[model samples]
Target: MPDQTTNAEKLDRDAVADRLTDLTEELRAGENVTVSVGNKDMVLTPPETVGYKIDVIKKQSRFRGNHETVRIEIDWKPR
Candidate 1:
């Protein structure tokens, strides 16, 4: 069986920048990142080598105006 996890949130620009900064530091230090949502949490440690992909989506609606999403995906084989 494969394990799956997800975390989603809504935040303002400043908060989003802070979150990105934290993620950058963690990646630079090669540390596991802990994902927590409510009372549930998980830690993910990436392998020494990994593959990366970026996906971007743009949307527009009569009522919603314009919206964009950027998703980054990482993949690696287990050691």
Candidate 2:
């Protein structure tokens, strides 16, 4: 079976930026990155290069109004 950990929450722009900044720093440091997902801690070791993807979605609804979502994904195989 495949193991996966996922976490999602509404965070302010600065908080989100801080999280991203930390992740970027860890990746640049060329070491395993420790991340918290929900209540669990996950350690990831990304290779020198990895797959990157970005997606943008816009939605409109009469009752829900309109919103845009930007999704970014980075993945790599562990050695």
Candidate 3:
């Protein structure tokens, strides 16, 4: 039989690294103004102007045979 695993399943490290890189770029560019995780929300204060913000949310694991998933949401406003 041949291997049926996907790159996503075999290497999840890149996904996180990619996210961090994207966030860093956004912050550095001042394109992201706010970030929200779960019920908590943080706004970028003055001198920290962000025109856009991306939010990544992951649900808590529940039950066996369940697969982990991620949801990404972006919030932006005109400067």
Candidate 4:
């Protein structure tokens, strides 16, 4: 049988990704926010006034089988 533990780990990672997405949106909306992942938390504040720019990149990788794998990548330049 496939490893059930691996499935659970994947689900947990997906949840984290969803949270990160939400935080990114909030940051772009000019909200000061802090995000915690694992043992680290990042505090972000939008630039003062308007016309500020922010760039974000996210990458993920997963191994599915002996020779199968998957990756997800997102790039954003917030205005």
Candidate models: Cα lDDT each: 0.75, 0.90, 0.50, 0.53
TM-score of each: 0.68, 0.89, 0.33, 0.33
How well does candidate 4 score on lDDT at residue 6?
17
Runs with alpha carbons beyond 4 Å of true place in candidate 2: none
Q: Lowest summed lDDT over 10 consecutive residues: which window, candidate 1?
A: 33-42
> TM-score winner among the candidates?
2
Question: Could you tell me which 10 consecutive residues in candidate 2 have the lowest summed lDDT?
Answer: 29-38
Q: What is the Cα-based lDDT of residue 27 in candidate 3?
A: 69
The clash number for model 1 is 0
Candidate 2 accuracy as TM-score = 0.89
Which clashing pairs does model 1 show? none
Model 1: residues with Cα > 4 Å off, grouped in runs:
62-64
CA RMSD of each candidate after superposition: 2.3, 1.2, 13.4, 12.0
lDDT of 3 by residue, 1-79 (tens): 8422223334488867875675667567754344444355555433443344455554565565445555554433434
Output the number of the lDDT-best candidate.
2
Cα lDDT tens digits, model 4, 1-79, are 7311212234587886897688768767776656554566655555544343454555455764334434443323323
Instruction: Report RMSD for candidate 3.
Output: 13.4
lDDT of 2: 0.90
- For model 4, the run of ten residues with the poorest summed lDDT: 2-11
Please report the TM-score between candidate 1 and the true structure.
0.68
